[model samples]
Target: MSSPEPRAPRYLVRRWGQLLLGLLLYGIAISLMIRADIGLDPWTVFAQGVARQSGWSIGIVTIVVGAIVLLLWIPLKQRPGIGTVLNVLLVGLALDLGLAFVRTPEELWARILLFAGGLALLALATGLYLGARFGPGPRDGLMTGAHARFGWAIWKVRTGVEVTVLAIGWMLGGTVGVGTVAFALLIGPMVHWTVPRLRVPAAGDPPRPARRRSARAQAAPA
Candidate 1:
């Protein structure tokens, strides 16, 4: 089913505001996961690893990494939208900002809670930004673009990329722990549950058709 149409002025306010808020939450989530010290997602793990080796902040590494990934999209003929650009800029900045205030807790249970909460927030952030319909993030675009260009299954593309990153990041001294396991298990379902409800209509997005008919009906002259 199509989303309800949201009108201008108010639409712009809600759209951009939600996008920014989502990005902010996403960055904070990344920071929380890092502070949790249990594990990190593959992309962040790669960033953390590179940061450790390069003596840069993880957030800086994240931005640099995103830009590089976006560049890869060009060869695949992917065009980035405003959301994509903001994803590159704001997420890393927010992460750094979050880190300035967030601390790693010593207790295991607290760390676990923080890690779980971070995952939940990340899922919601994803839905919010995506629902705004500005565009997909660099990483997501890379996957989708690859799928479009090479005709590889989405799962194949995503898995290969993530595994490669995870291996490289782990080799580079990024921490991988129970949190990683938790993320892998919970993220898909959590995002699935949240996205449909949380999504807002994107500007200029087409509405979904109400229903489908049989082949004969579909093939009939308009």
Candidate 2:
């Protein structure tokens, strides 16, 4: 089903606010994970690697990487929305700010708490921004674009990309530990739970009818 159009100005404002807040929280979540000294998600690991190599902050590397990834979308015929641009810009700024204010706790228990909290917050942040329905972030766009262009399975595309980044990041001195495995196993289910509940209802949206799977959809693998 198609999403409702943004006809009301108030809903538009709410969407924008949700998107910005989600992005900001996403950055802070990353900072929490970093301070926890646990393993990071693949993209963040890549950013950490690049930061280590370049002597830049992880946030700076994230921005540069996002911009570069966004460029690839042009060839894939993917259109970027306003949220995409802000994601590339604001997430990095927020990450830096978060790092400045959030310190690493010396206690292992505290560190674990931070990591767990970060993981949960990251899933929620993902739902919030995506629920706003402005657009997918640059990294997500890259995966979807590749799937569109190459007809690759989405899981294959995601796994391949993440594994490659993780390998490179590890080689470049990024941390890899139990948390990476935990993130991989938990995030998909977490996002699944969050996204549907978190989505912003369109202004004047009608109640949706229960959907039955089409033959093609039913035939598809779970």
Candidate 3:
């Protein structure tokens, strides 16, 4: 007689949970930064620019942007996992929900606090999702795909892409301010610190190679 069906591995379930939670938190963090209205990271600036021009909400723009980026993955021979797909769908919805509930503050101190909280939350979320190892987000996948396709250094690819987007975003009237500088300065180190600590261990996991983001600014997945 056939035995009862085997259950899914607990770690698989845990990984899925972590991915979802991380994406949700990432969206909320983005919303917080937007409400702070001081500045935003590069991709968010791009989203804001598109949102401004298209008259769509930033969350909607985010989803559209993610989908578009995913399409670009095809030519680069990038394959996506369920985590990547969900990252595209879920983060934007969460961002909109978060924006609905969170309000902007009038005081400079309060705005600074909000941006700081958002940045911290964003860093934590990046660790959780990436540590799950389901897949890279669309933006990150693009950078890696370009590196592999062209044999460019990861840092060079990242810088070129971000600078291009930053230029377009600025031209499209997205906010560019101190927060943008702060994000560029801080996110790499923060992600480097958090990812190692938060990464989940699996039975057959391979040893990850050491990366030197300190020497080169390695932006986390947007």
Candidate 4:
């Protein structure tokens, strides 16, 4: 008999802790974006624009958009894991709370620096949070679900979604400035570089059953 494949770890407290840290990092990132006076991420841009248009708080717009995204998960049969749900909720809450105290930068150079710094911080947070392997954010989960359903490349699907969000956000009055363009170009590379370094060893788990394969087929393949 063959040995089982290794399963991913499932430490609830540890995962939650990672998520909390990610959330804090995310907050800092958003604060930097605001300070930059540049555009926010596509999702945040949409939320901020909607908040401005509808006279709703940015947090409220975030919740609404998150709920809408969460609904998309149901049809895909993707359950909302803890990290996923928290991501939807905590990001908005953090933005609101952080903005309460943090002031936007007054100078153009300061704004530019803050924007770049924000992107880096956001990338770091994403790496740490995803490293926990708990679950993906709504947007990421949506991309994953689409990839599974349509056999599309994850990057293509993700890019299309972000483009759509950016368009809508721009139409609704979100700041789509140099920073937005910079982030669009830089975020993926930053996340790729940071995630492996940030990933901790998968702890407290045993192996799972490996899928059975035919020996002749394996031999034939290479």
Candidate 5:
């Protein structure tokens, strides 16, 4: 009889589990922040704006926006991996689920807890998903693709796109404040702290080179 095929390495299984957890946490983080009501992050502000204009739920708008952004990847020849697909579907579902359970708190301290907790969770979520190395999300792809195709600096591309989105979303009445600024300033450090520690090495993967966030402002956390 032919020898049994070698089993897949254990780390692969762990990686998949981590990926799911990360995505779930990401969705929860978004819900917590929105419910916190202190502010909406930039991409989220865009989703809120579009939700207002289209009358769709924020989760639905988020999914639609992700899909549209994914389509843009075609011209750049960027491909979505398993992580990419999951990020699109799961984060929105989690957001809606979180919203269902979490009501807007009446007390200021409660809101503060939600905001601070959400920020930390979002950073951890970023590390889990990106470190899994399945692929970047639709929004991340948009930033990277623009930089590659246009030969613009990563920060310049990321900043221009995000600022424009923020403006449009703000105009549409998306809440903005301390949360927005905090997310903008702190996420890089947060992701920096978390990504390196949790990253799953490839099966037989070589010594890892430094991994950089292709865009300065990812703005893609759940």
Candidate 6:
């Protein structure tokens, strides 16, 4: 027997809830980064460094980075959707808010634990948010755009971007340490695991037409 079609309402509601929860988890992940005090994520590190050097708010720095990344999407023919815009704004705001209240851990072990846990949660949140299928994050969209335009492998493109950003941020006095390395290594797996678990509408659900019965063949068999 064929399986019944999945309900749209069930999928939509679950996706929406996951999106909200994902954002919150992202916020907590940033908070954990702040508390860890080892280092920020490469992108966040860049934003923080720019903020420090330019005397701009971290949020403003983030907006600028995201805007620049978004502009790259034009040549690649990737339109900015609601989720994309939200990701650009929300991530900065969430980071700023998280930093405001999250105090740095005093002990080394505490910091290390926070860094590992935070990195995992951040990856998980990214996957959950993306599973909504609304759009990709600005940085992610930028990487994808570059991959399409330059014909570079995604891993190579991503590694180059991360390395360049991390080096610049470090030169500008952003923290670069064990946490940065940990994030780079572990985030991919965490996202791969979490995204599949969040409920989203299946793209392969469209119905296929039933095959016509061959009357001659059927009569011979009977």
Error of 3 at 192 (Å): 0.7
Q: Which residue runs does candidate 6 get wrong by more than 4 Å?
A: 1-10, 203-222
lDDT of 1 by residue, 1-222 (tens): 755566768878888987899888999999999999999999999999999999999999999999999999989999999999999999999999989998999999999998988998999998888877788899999999999999999889989999899999999999899998888888889888877666675546666667779999999999
lDDT of 6 at 167: 86
Across 1-222, the per-residue lDDT of candidate 2 in tens digits comes to 666576788988888888999999999999989888878899888999989999999999999999999999999899998889999998999888889999989998998899999999999999999999999899999999999998998889989989999999989988788778888999999999998878898656667677998999999999
Candidate 6 local Cα displacement, residue 198, angstroms: 1.8
Which residue runs does candidate 1 get wrong by more than 4 Å? 1-7, 202-222
Per residue, candidate 3 scores C-alpha lDDT tens digits across 1-222 of 544433468867778888999999999999999999889999999999988999999999999999999999999999998889989999999999999999999998999999999999999999999988889899999999999998999999899989988889989989889899999999999999999887877655566778767633556553
TM-scores vs. true structure, each candidate? 0.88, 0.88, 0.87, 0.82, 0.86, 0.82
**What stretches of model 3 exceed 4 Å from their correct place?**
1-9, 205-222
Candidate 3: which pairs clash? Answer: none
Q: What is the C-alpha lDDT of each candidate?
A: 0.90, 0.90, 0.91, 0.79, 0.87, 0.79
Structure candidate 5, residue pairs in collision: none
- Candidate 5 accuracy as TM-score: 0.86
Alpha-carbon shift of residue 21 in model 6 (angstroms): 2.8
The digit string of per-residue lDDT tens for model 6 on 15-39 reads 7776766766786787688579788
- Where does candidate 4 have its weakest 10-residue lDDT segment? 1-10
Clashes of 6: 0
Cα displacement (angstroms), candidate 5, residue 72, comes to: 1.0
lDDT of 4 at 27: 64
Model 2, residue 96: distance off in Å is 0.9
Runs in model 4 lying further than 4 Å from the true structure:
1-14, 203-222
Candidate closer to the true structure by lDDT (higher is better), 1 or 4? 1
